[model samples]
Target: MDWNRTKSIFIVVFLILNIFLYSLYVNRYNEAQSVEVAGEKTIDARLKEDNITYGVLPNSVESATYISGKVHTFTAADFTDPNHQANITDPKEARVILLSPVKLRNVNDDASFTEFVQANIKEGGSYGLWKVNRDERIAIFFQKTNNRMLYYNKSGLLKIQWNADNEVTMYEQTMLDNIEEVEQQESALPPIQVIQALYAKGLLKPDSRIEHMQLGYSTLVYLTQTQVLLPTWEVRVKLSDGEIEEYFVDAVEGKIIEIQEEKQEVEEEDWGV
Candidate 1:
């Protein structure tokens, strides 16, 4: 006899329960949004407290994929100069000594040096000027693929040595063969996220300045013949003491890449020609 009234009561109770659950969900969503906002503001505040300054952060999101290539083997036909001496014994490299040191129009100008490389070296157009060591009398260039430089890759590098007279006396070169993307494209972490990751890891010091941020590739794996590369964000920082430091962050995975200085040194010594 009271079944109808009991059913009405149950419906009302269930309706009230749904309303309460909806309220809880709405509150949780708002709280999550607030936390995200606070987290971003905290990053800026922390940097400021540490006296760390940075230029404009990159706003655009980018996508990239892993790349792989075999080290190119140089041949005698690659070097045709009769007077200059070329050492292609390594097969993967070419070390050339100019019979006459090529004088630059402007020793201090990068374009002048780049011009010489483009004209004389094989596949030279693919290399970009990286840096010059005055004391060592050498200029280094890193190879580029798809307009992004492969950072400190020995397989795709050009090392030019100059004399006291500022003449390009000799150069060594290596290149990647069949360079191509190897994986599905993935979205790269935004520049700000990468910077925050470095700061969180204590890689960025107090009272420092983030001088520059660039996109590039770094060695992920070195095999017998092929090298695997990962897209990375290169962050350059200026410490409070005025010294510059560089760090690479895995763009897709957000991991800090520890560059192996010892490995690079061994490579240089092993292929010293």
Candidate 2:
């Protein structure tokens, strides 16, 4: 055998294989770019035709992981405070009703209200004020995990009902326990892509304005004792009729999530004040 000749032939074959692989990679990259460009143009045209406008879209891509937690069961031992009376409505759901009133120095002051919660409520520091309804005289707080809100999760909510005197007469609470990340970090869909998803689904109407877009977590699966949550994008839109609507999109799978309306109004009689 001709040693030099054999070595040269092997080298030539390796070079050919490398060239073939490189060409394939370039072709795939170009095709991906073309598809992305086409998608952008299509979305832009559709949005213009529908007269849809949006505020500044988030540009940075983010990664998140799936989290799971079990709802904490409330027991009499959990509430040892002498000032408030705690009623455990549902032990499995960890629902508690507080009957005693705790006056707030200033509900309008964030720091003051936070101090009140921390001093009066259990695991209160983990909750953040989500909304205040003056008509219902109620303030709703949601629990935060790793500094991010578990949006609209029933097992992690605190609802406080206050009288006209600015005294918190009653409240309902739920909490989650053993919270931990259940999956590896995965890249989430960008905000603009989520908008496009809503647009494609015909959820975005003509002359609508996207007011806000935020990343949060929504319940992906609910069980008897535990729940799984996924990264979600919450988009708030102002319709032409001046009505504000909120939509959620699954950031990982780009699917629209239909969230049922949770009643915020608490009857005066229910407060037992």
Candidate 3:
């Protein structure tokens, strides 16, 4: 009937659709590369620099310490490993130590990848399996005290990541041979308490959904021999805009701590203007 009018309307609708699709793509792309942390701009590049590179993060002497029931006394032998490029701080409350990867490699995923990790980690020492992340090629295992899990901030008794070749590319760990002598076990803060604390801190936003939650042990101090870890609650959240974020709560104190992967909670900000 009205051929010219119909043609014009069709063109206008097509242009609107194109614009809408472009906006969606741009939003997702920006969200992937960058995020806001506690109202500050942050990037994956910055976090990765200080986070776990191969298996563990860089450890240094940190003056800051937290109060805990466990304590590790050290002198000078813990940092003497020159072969692994190990770095250790004088034993204190919450200090961490880091070691360079012994034989780092990047490989594709295959059948043997899981087997290598499982076997070597078992061979390294038997601990409770806390988490396994194939995406990042890392497996987390923790030390248990009195049937209660001890959670550290970013580390466990042992953390490992393998490549496609099934070679142990990165391995970082703390000593846990005699945890009882250095510390005592206490009831962990319940999961409900952690969730509430996260909500109070504006972590669980409106329209957000929980992706996963787990309990594990993370290291508080990297001592001469072992790391002292406590119970930790890990909560992964997917925001309304479809971005995944991880929140870590101290299972003992009901407070948030820095994870080795990421330590800051950034606000979702769009910088692609």
Candidate 4:
């Protein structure tokens, strides 16, 4: 047997096997890297995708019907901060968000807060404010549409807050977001009709004096999970004994709506004469 020749042949075979193994390893490693890169596309590459093209959704009549008025644009790019971030979510859904003393000027309690809000919003400005509930320090104003007036906390409408000094300290608003302008603005019942409906419900007394009558949006259902705001007429009634009562009537249907009412306790008298 030729030992040197056999040894040389064995060495060559081993070298060939090592080269084949290395090639296989390199191919598998390359395949793994390729799969990882393909998992998530880069921003530029994603923009080029057939479905994505851009960030905005395509225009459709159905989509437009859900949104109202012109596309409102208000962004506080300067308000962006890591320490004191804004409490705004879903820019598409949140139309108006204003922080006090930030981009806000000339705010006062003497209806100035309401005035400032009216100036900010182009459509459905509050012509006559409907006074709802207020203490010595705070005053709230509601905007009136063609049909009825709406309050701040009622239907996610504009909420303006002014301090006792008559300067608008702060205000929170969520209008123009997902707005759907309908052709029918004059759909609600008038204030007089709303008052008659309240009388029909036995809520108003013969001597009940109407202190204030204003239109606003009422919360049909305001819950942590969901919310609904409907057009309503708010009437402040004062009885003969000097007691105040608040009544809400549906603006569209002219029906009385009672959310929560307090129970009255009367003293019983014994007739044991």
Candidate 5:
């Protein structure tokens, strides 16, 4: 065997592997820090100026709000008592407002989150959940509200992390609340009524791999349909023991909308290059 030739090939392969790993590392790192919107680059930066920390991000407002073509705003608020008469050793309070790169409406608490999630499910869009504390939780559905972003957690119970394409992720508590709503609603609908509805619509076709369907804001079910594979436009349906269930139906038009699939379909583009 040619020892030198074998050694050279191993070195080349090792270098290529390292380069591939490095590229992946760089791409994931970039996605974690920045979100791209409307052909603009936006990043979250924390700066201490004059002993105050401010979060720097691109100006999302329409009116050319940045003085130097960039915007620096307060991300968290100070809770120092303005009425204090003397300096004390108590821990200073902090009020943090989570921001989304996508413009979203602010919901005050968990109840509002539930309402918003229900509305979005009815309208056919994706929803996110927020957990302010261990027991405090909220769910937000996209496209149901006018604002594309949502901010919550003044007391630090919620944390918002934005990905490269304005995708928002929250803790498990929030996801559970959102999923639970759909399950509960479907349980209340009569099974015989559900099967009859499918039969009337000519949806119970043989040899079809029926997936789950989404109903108005609260229920998702599986059903037998003529179409073996579900298109993105169809409501999520599932069929089990001849019972049909629906999820994420458009309240107005009865159209199915898959918000998560839509977000994942965006093409990867060079950012900050």
Candidate 6:
């Protein structure tokens, strides 16, 4: 029997299998990385198309810096904490408030935002859109977390600003006469219900995946925005005559902010996904 030769063959085969497995792992890793980069590029393209001027999305402010002019750069680093608010230190003048003082990020879902809005604040239907009264800017950000809603904002700073305002200070204090009154409460609207309403109204596409959404409004001025990543713009419907509209619409106000067609990428390959 050729036992020594058999053992040598087995070792060679084992080494080859290990090499094959390592190659597979490397290939898979590269594929996942590519997908993430593509997703980020898609997001950046959308932002540019919408005319939203933002420096690179900063993971941390450590890499962030204020360049000359009105431009700022946000580097890729995680934020110190959700508590970190956008600095308004360079008050040679009041900042143009390009993005607003409120920083919205890491939103898990829409309901968390609506609920937070419904609580701490009061929502009275006004001119068809849901209105909440507050003097300072309130920012809301959205991100998918475990398939649930997540919200990020400078709530603490907002509260401070509201308290400083003499006009709404009294009103807010009256509303918070008791500690329990001011405590955080979940939204009365369920996550599914809120999503369903947007869907039924055709404001949100059935297949749209909301990555980052923001809401900014101050009683002194009228500015409201909601941004979401959608698969198509064919979902928006006109409330005037129940006609199907697509893409951008002021779902909250029943108005159109702007409607821009999705940009298609040109590919050289005739048959490609």
Candidate number of the best lDDT: 1
The lDDT per prediction is 0.86, 0.80, 0.50, 0.47, 0.29, 0.28
Per-residue alpha-carbon lDDT of candidate 5 for residues 173-197, written as tens digits (9 for 90 to 100): 1111111111111122222233234
Best of the candidates, TM-score: 1
Per-residue C-alpha lDDT of model 4 across residues 106-159, encoded as one tens digit per residue = 433345545555665334363344442345333344434444443433333443
- lDDT winner between 1 and 5, please give it: 1
- Write candidate 1's Cα lDDT for 70-163 as tens digits: 9998888888877568888789878888998888767778897799888877788999988876777778888999888898888888888888
Error of 2 at 193 (Å): 2.1
lDDT of 4: 0.47
Give lDDT tens digits, candidate 3, residues 1-273: 899999999999999999999999999888865643322223223323433111222232112222233343433454444433332442431122224333333344343433444454322334455555676666655545544445433322456665565446555544344454344555566544555577667666666666666665556665545455555667777776788777777766778877654222111111121
Q: Where is model 3 more than 4 Å wrong at Cα? A: 1-114, 121-175, 181-185, 260-273
Residue range 101-212, candidate 6, lDDT tens digits: 2322223333333433333332111101122224242222222211211111111011212123221111110010011111232223222222334444545533234332
TM-score: the better of candidates 2 and 6: 2
State the number of backbone clashes in model 1: 0
TM-score, candidate 2, is 0.81
Q: What TM-score against the true fold does each predicted structure earn?
A: 0.84, 0.81, 0.42, 0.44, 0.19, 0.27
lDDT of 2 by residue, 1-273 (tens): 999999999999999999999999999999999999899889988898989998788764679889999998889887787666766666743333445667788877656566667778889999988777677777778888887788888888887777888887767778899999999999999887898999989899999999988787888898988999998888899999999898889989999987664322222225442
lDDT of 1 at 156: 87
- Per-candidate RMSD, Å: 4.7, 3.4, 21.2, 25.3, 25.4, 21.2
CA error at residue 15 for candidate 5, angstroms = 98
Candidate 6 lDDT trough over 10 residues, lowest sum: 170-179
How many clashes show up per model? 0, 0, 17, 10, 29, 14
